[model samples]
Target: MANSPQSKKRARQAVRRNDVNKARRSRIRTYLRKVEEAIASGDKAVAQDALKNAQPELMRGVTKGVVHKNTAARKISRLAARVKALG
Candidate 1:
């Protein structure tokens, strides 16, 4: 439905951005799942390490606009608390 040339270009850009954002979101979820599995397995050391690795990935998601800043903060906070409680 993009009749204008500009609109066509915009549509193309949107598709590319959507694909990139989807990949980034999937990657972030994989990292979070790693942390969750580690936590569920009751291994504090592995959970701590997974959380450590996930922090940068989550922050990257925020910086790339795939995730909200406050949402990232809340997620990291809760995950850290859960990891800590595994003590």
Candidate 2:
């Protein structure tokens, strides 16, 4: 639906950015899922390790604009609390 040449170029660029961002989002979700599964296993050590690994990945996603800072922080906080309560 982009008529002008510039608009078409912008649209194309947006498509590429969307694909990259989608991949980043998926990667972040996978990291989060790992932490969740580790927690569900009731192994504090494994859950802690998974949370350690996921923290940086989630922060990276924030910096890349794929995830919001507060959202990531809230998720980390909640997951940490759950992991702590596992004992």
lDDT of 1 at 76: 98
lDDT of each: 0.98, 0.97
Listing every candidate in turn, what is its Cα RMSD in Å to the true structure after a full C-alpha superposition?
Answer: 0.5, 0.7
Per-residue C-alpha lDDT of model 2 across residues 42-75, encoded as one tens digit per residue: 9999999999999999999999999999999999
- C-alpha TM-score for every candidate: 0.98, 0.96
Q: Write the per-residue lDDT of candidate 1 for residues 1-87, one digit (tens) a residue.
A: 999999999999999999999999999999999999999999999999999999999999999999999999999999999999999
List the candidate 2 regions with Cα displacement exceeding 4 Å. Answer: none
TM-score leader: 1
Candidate achieving the largest lDDT: 1
TM-score of 2: 0.96
Tell me how far the alpha carbon of residue 51 in candidate 2 is from the true structure, in angstroms, after superposition: 0.3
